[model samples]
Target: MASPWRPIRVWSPLLGLGFVVALIAFALQLSSRRHLAQRLWTFEELALYNGTDERLPILLGILGSVFDVTKGKTHYGPGGGYHHFAGRDASRAFVSGNFTGDGLTDSLNGLSTMEVKSVVDWRKFYMERYIFTGHLVGRYYDSQGKPTKYLKGVESKAKRGAQLLEKQKIEEDKIPSCNSKWSQQEGGKVWCDSGYPRLVKRPGDIALTGKISQRCACFKEEELGRPGLEVYKNCDYLSQSCSV
Candidate 1:
């Protein structure tokens, strides 16, 4: 006669393999659910998660992107100082420093280079500190939820501005230092300074000589002697030419 435990021992290896396969399938299901939960949210759906109803997470939008700010409820909740920004694409507000609804649009038209920089900084702040949820459908996106021409234009403008700023920094660094002769009689006088000539141009070919003359006049006093004359002495020539 054979022992009854012989059959159990023979099937144990097959059972163990089945268990391993089940565990792998379970893990894949969980991954799929997590990915689905993080799908893109429309503006209307985002409004429901503003932390006001106490049933959903706190969410905010900036630069056509949505973020899960639930972890920062103290600052993003209903009574929080930034609660007004919840559920809206407030990129313009971030740059303009206006927390009101009027500033809560994604439109960056007519904003200055400095303002665009502020928006970019704010976007970076959100990206670093919060969970990225999805993209907001707004001026940056079309009705079909694709990136719009306006969005491309904004990106190009920002790129150009960055390039211009870099160029300005390089030019500023190239400015020659001035040699100064100090005497009780002359007080302080800048000599042996090489001037850098920058051409000024505007639309319609208007002559700007009068404006240039006015700016040059302001540099005259600094040419003589002032307490903060060191900076002017070193970059006076560059200053007169460039807008720096």
Candidate 2:
């Protein structure tokens, strides 16, 4: 009769403590799930976040590398020009300029020089513009998701090609101008001695001097206006006889 509710009141502290512990446990579980989501995602899981649901982010893959393109949803989302590339590697497609499913692969075999260069350019573009997530485990990667030999080869080729391109540019800048000159009477013209080497014989090869096969005509100014155009405009220098 002192107080009918006294017993329940005395146990209130314990019940409150239990509730606090349960809440903390639930919070920890939620945090762990969030962390897992931010970690590496498999290709199948990536496809689930293709911006189609409006709840997940938009993502894309290139050469086995994944990127978060959510920031570019306007261009990568549904009905966007690049929507087809989302949630897939599609490295070959980028290089071959093929937007079909058949091009959605990482295989670099049989790609021409320009195509390979295109793939390299696309890789640089993604790296500079998007957030890198992880790699895909198909075509460009092995079962365990490690980079495959083919991928490595393609990368090596890209690097080598870039280096070669840079070198070629430098060499081109150093080429001695065929000392081209302009004359009103003859129009623009360039005269090469009996022995003069070509500026470029093959791709990336430095120009080497060669003996003249025959006395050639002076090149017209208009013909020499473009690089390597003079070679096709050879004529008898004495008479300046050649098709302009």
Candidate 3:
């Protein structure tokens, strides 16, 4: 005869485990909502947490996102090396390396697409290293904590920068860069071990930056005369090497 205890033994563990998982998931969701609720901080409020007062936690802002960097007190405190970056959104300075006076501003104006992407990358670095606290209500975000048009534009440029970088990597794999060297006695020389050296438009340079950029690359004989490829000046069309 089948015993009732057998059914309890089979189902009890599964039911208990399911209940525990549901409880943990609910707790995580609630915690996330609480954190997100802390969004929308004014610049003045952010400035108060610059690690001057022991009572307040050290905070830093980047790309509108604020993070609790209290654990890095040695690096962000009043006398720390990165103190200028604390309690302010100096997004541009991440790449500009100008951390004083006007350079500490959050303006991304006139920055190149790749520079803007570098600023975004710095934000990602902080996000992974510190606890996210809130959003700063200025240039990058509105008082209601929504992204501003300027912020959206920066993100779009950054995305384009990433695409450009990927395209460049693909192009490099297809046409590897040529080996090069320079000397006062020998001038400059570029060559390939197995293919001819040619100059080609840098991937995405003109479209993204409106500047025509080119680089020397090695290409197989059959790959010559591609749309962007041009023979080096003073070098034979099929020569594997060139001097500059």
Candidate 4:
């Protein structure tokens, strides 16, 4: 009873509507994929989940993994671990250097030049976070800048750091008592005393997720008649690290 054209018109509109729905769904999927690719934790799919679970190590490890592939090497060198921690605007306290923007370069004091008030055990939580969050180091070039491959984890870097620690121990053996004077250039030949600032925890500084805090509050005081600490009270988290 229907005309041939009626069948064509009905089916064509239905088909067109179906195609439009399908197209919209496809576009949504593509958008989702793009967002997921940009994310640090691909396996966790944070898009549909709570985003707070993500932190520095999660992001840094993702970056390191991709960088390892791009450069074809582990950045931490053989038996070295690469780590990154998020400091909340630490540069405001001590930097007055020549640089621009939000980066480590913004910190005025060179890594080497500060005084050590005490040992806050930065190495302790440092290793612990690296252990919990995990790591991937890429050191593609040797001293001569030649190509290499593969990567290592915290255990490896700690072993290498241990060698450096040992060298420090040997040097310490040569200098007896706290009265002895010593200095080292940490970055850019910036010289300073290298001990002091024991980390102590303050109350109400705890987080259920991610790292707590640790601080090296001051450099050794006796050096140059002024004490120095490897790290000082730079953040609330650092205060929390000592709370225990």
Query: What is the number of residue pairs that collide in model 4?
Result: 44
Ranking by lDDT: 3, 2, 1, 4
Q: By how many angstroms RMSD does model 3 differ from the true structure?
A: 10.8
Please provide, for model 3 over 76-121, each residue's C-alpha lDDT reduced to its tens digit, 9 standing for 90 to 100.
9989999998888888899899999999988989888888888999
Model 1 pairs whose backbones collide = none
Model 2 TM-score is: 0.59
Q: Per-residue lDDT of 1-244 in model 2, one digit per residue for the tens?
A: 4766554436588899999999987887566335333345567976776768665667888877888888899988999998888877777888577888677766777775546767878988989998777677766777676778878888777776677667856765554433456667877554344323233333542211112222223333444444643343465423332333
TM-score of each: 0.57, 0.59, 0.70, 0.22
Best by TM-score: 3
lDDT per model vs. reference: 0.62, 0.64, 0.85, 0.30
- Cα error, residue 99 of model 3, in Å, equals 1.3
Across residues 12-84, which tens digit of lDDT does each residue of candidate 1 receive? 8889999999998788756633642545667787777777865456788876778888788888897888887
Q: Which parts of model 2 have CA positions greater than 4 angstroms off?
A: 1-40, 143-145, 176-202, 205-244
Best-performing candidate as measured by lDDT: 3
Q: Write candidate 4's Cα lDDT for 20-71 as tens digits.
A: 9999878875664443342223223311222122211122222122111112
Candidate 4's TM-score = 0.22
